[model samples]
Target: MTMEKLIRFAALAFFSIAPMAVATAQDSADYHVTVTLNWTEAAFPVGFPEDPHFSRFIGMTHNERFTLFADGQTASTGLGLVATNGRVSILKAELGEMTRRKRIGSVVEADALKAGAGVVQMTATLTSAHNRFSFATMVAPSPDWITGASGIVLNPDGPWLESLTLPLWVWDAGVDGGQTFTSPDDPLPVKESVRLAATPYFLHPAGLLPIGTVVFVRVR
Candidate 1:
């Protein structure tokens, strides 16, 4: 081949391969998440239970197409299990399906907070394609109350936030009719949309107080 022709072919090959490389390259960031539960009787004196505690926490790093839980939406069977029974096996299976479908990047789980006031930490990896996070945990001994945050964007624009804190509010799974912490299992005849807990249990004299907080800090 002629020198000019060889040079032209080489340039075309490099440009084509460069575009493919750029398309396949994905930027990822690591974060350390700290979940602190403040559901002490001191902070929430109303209707304090005997053993105030939080259930096992489950979270996901996902893209815009996925949601762990959302307000005004019906709870999935797996989420219902968490809220009603503080179980994670079914939810983990659901997350596995989501992973197979490429809807989520990672599933993060943590040990339960045995006391009302404690902290649980976990690490997560977020890619540019999946920069949002969602998490949830049940209010132990409750009928169907849960606490969590959903649709949180770790990287809104191009840069990841150094640190972000989100207040955790109690939500009703709408799967049970029992209102108290130790109420017996009473499944609702029809499912209701998930929403913030409005029962007197969570209501304070001042207003609704958050039960916990989740803090995300970029580690790398």
Candidate 2:
């Protein structure tokens, strides 16, 4: 099989063979998630384009046994695809397999968003076991810049009573060395993914900063 096919097959096989976790009993609940991409001159360099835009938003509501990406852990090949190429098919397929296995409750993907202002909203199901949400989106033109939250617990101690909004920070997939928005290069796999250093690593002369916000609301 070709490398791409191999990747897809591997992803499918992974979730297929993985054991399902024992779910904890809890009252079922639904959540409305609103993810907004808000970028201003303060967030990115002046040279950032309005066209190419950020890649689609990809995420999953899953149990603690599953996570998409971690701060100091190695990034999966599906994550590498989203972070570097703005592609979602591979990851989506993988998540689909996970959903079938009951490892993930649901998967989410939004269209490519423009530079300044864009919003995508979706609803997700949550149980006591599958109470965490994780997501990611690629920063265009760069080698492997991405942004999203990992392991956001819906209701840690009690039920969510109010809507919550949090600032989203930029991350380096640690898989590429390019520094610019449009870094002309191929994916460079790293030993592992780490939190992007605090130093300015983007087009902004001053360095990197929070580029957006994510809002989660309890609808029922």
Candidate 3:
């Protein structure tokens, strides 16, 4: 074949294959995450109740279209259930709905923490379209307290991060009026926006205590 013709064919082939290669590279990635709870009595001694535990960890990979929960935003009914009662079914259903709408890529759930200090590991898959991770787990024995991260970007500028460690802070779902860890079920007169837990129950001389840390490591 002529050199010009061969070069033209090569150019066409390269263009066709380049897009597929890029797509495959950015299509999806898997990550192994370790959630370490440190809500020990020694770390947070003020009114630390007995049998401190955490509800099952639940999360999802989503894009800008969805958010599990955010500070200053009203908690959805599903999130309210998780915060108030440690129930995950409703929130899982909500995530399913978003998946059907193509707003999410995957839903991840992990074992609950039966003690104040422990670790739960989970694997999550993220897609190029849904590269953000959001998760929550209730701080049991509390009225509507939870600890989790929201809308953490795993792939910020086209490359997935190798690893990340995030500090988990206590948050109030704003669905209950209780002030203590073991406070009875008391629905707020008016539902308020979610915010960091600031009641005396979570406050300390050094500022609010972090409940845990979540570490994400990309495996593939």
Candidate 4:
């Protein structure tokens, strides 16, 4: 075979299961790949506003870089930011799975998702190894949630990663545990909870908090 033809074949065969001829090597090579992902949302029964409820969005960011909770360690700052925002209840994910791959883009498709609702439709497209891949997730008996079949793409020369979003449960900084939502005048506006003057607020958990959810990885 001529040098030009051999180069062309190598470019097209990166993900191929075909055996390679070690003797016939090329100067430089590149490959392409893609992926399609689907996601859904589900919330534990928090009930009506008169009974208030909450949910979460578990995502694997570009290259799956880092994660919040470790097996025996504490949650970090980035994750803490998410948790604070989700006040009522939400899993703050750090990140995980920082691969050699790049982030082309991701998509989130859904009709509508209610706070306490179980399901919301979503989909994503990812590019890797000069090719494209797709997957979806679906939870049974719940329109509020759905996940597609995951098409995994692993690298013989790449990395492994994981990240997650956990369930939401009510929390109140202990100093003012019994405080209700209200208005207070100061240099800054009063936030979510009411004031119990002359007291300090601390971490105090309430309600049924959710367990951690896993972020699935795709191997090419």
Candidate 5:
């Protein structure tokens, strides 16, 4: 099926069966998570000549020690790959190390998406030590731009009983020169750590355009 159609179908199916899919995962698997990244027409950034785009999603469920990125932290070699080139190989391999060490629970990846919306789902094994989740994707044709979630908690005080949704925003990978798209000198490292973009685009404030939505559902 076409990507747009598939996204719509996935959303529909989720909402349609969600009421019946809330069984406790302790009975079988650990956790069943369905994460959807969406960009509605109304939420699309304005005053841009072209539509924004996104790289494939790369997500992980890990322990407290496994950090993806923080506002003031250094961007890892893996994060640099996605933020600069829309690539996931390096990040996946890096995360694989944590998997072997049992520092992380699971890692998930999905295909690149166009200017609109897309959905990617992952299943996570439950553990008190590894209860945080993080996911990210690159915004293309810009200098080290990205959007994702970090340190999302599951079953904080009790069993996870409700679905959660969070608004996505753009982030600067801090390795860029903050120049125009495809600029040769762009993304020149400033020796600075990762942080939010100072300006996401010309018309919108930092990290505000093409405002994406991320939905997390517990389906086990």
Candidate 6:
């Protein structure tokens, strides 16, 4: 078979076996992690917990392996996932708490939230083998505009691979005119215009915010 097909088949096989693989290696796994974050959006009719504002982010980070956002590039794949699905979810987990919750994605189109911006919940999932893996999703409002790694399974990080997977977010794939969000003409984050061609990467912890964004991918 072709190389691309081979890779896809191999990934499916690995996922099929992942249950046992995970059980056996649960303890020895390189990283054991849990992420929890809360967000508030003025776009919502109310406030935190009850108000149900803007968006949410659900992703995973491995030992310096992956990130929801890419760097050097602009924008995020997560956001693209939102607009396409029109709905997603971000699950909040508490260590040993046995409780999980989901929330909405972003609303970059909202006029009220345009100036104030929006708040987003975040969760992350990471793998020990590759820098890529399928990411989680959050759904609430329509026009979903944020998401994280999805079915991500990158090959082991060599010095070069490690160097690439630094802080970053998701972006529209241009599959459906990526940069065409909200309007037919210029996209909101005009600076991100170049990002329409490929997936973006940013090393900033706060993600792309306040315009004039900078993307840096760092390994930790």
Q: Which predicted model would earn the best lDDT?
A: 3
Could you arrange the candidates by TM-score from highest to lowest? 3, 1, 2, 5, 4, 6
Cα lDDT of candidate 6 equals: 0.32
Candidate 5: TM-score?
Answer: 0.74
Candidate 4, TM-score vs. the true structure? 0.30
Q: Write the per-residue lDDT of candidate 4 for residues 1-220, one digit (tens) a residue.
A: 9999999899778636334453122211222222222121322322212322223333332333332232223333333323333221222211221233343123232332233334343333333331222222212112112222122333323332222222322222122122322212121122232111121111224533332122333321
In model 5, the worst 10-residue window by lDDT is 23-32
Candidate 2 per-residue lDDT, tens place, 92-169, comes to: 888888888887987877777766567877777777657888888887756787888888888877764357788788
lDDT of 5: 0.71
For residues 1-220, what per-residue lDDT tens digits would candidate 6 score against the true structure? 9999999999999999999975654322222122222222432223212322223333333333223334333434433444444333312222012112211121112111222233332222233433333333332232223433433333353322222232223344332442322323333443332121222221235434221111112223
**Candidate 2's C-alpha lDDT?**
0.74
- lDDT for 137 (candidate 4): 24
The local distance difference test score of model 3 is 0.90
Candidate numbers, best lDDT first, in rank order: 3, 1, 2, 5, 6, 4
Clashes of each: 0, 4, 0, 43, 2, 50
Give TM-scores for every candidate, taking all chains together and pairing residue i with residue i: 0.88, 0.77, 0.91, 0.30, 0.74, 0.29
Question: Least accurate stretch of 10 residues (summed lDDT) in model 3?
Answer: 200-209
If both were scored by TM-score, which would come out higher, candidate 1 or candidate 6? Answer: 1
Give one digit per residue, the lDDT tens place, for model 5 in 62-158.
8888889888898888998889888999999999999999878888776777765566566665555677789888877677878888888876766
The ten-residue window of minimal lDDT in model 6 covers 95-104
Best by TM-score: 3
Candidate achieving higher TM-score, 2 or 4: 2
lDDT of each: 0.89, 0.74, 0.90, 0.28, 0.71, 0.32
Give the clashing pairs for model 5.
176-187, 177-187
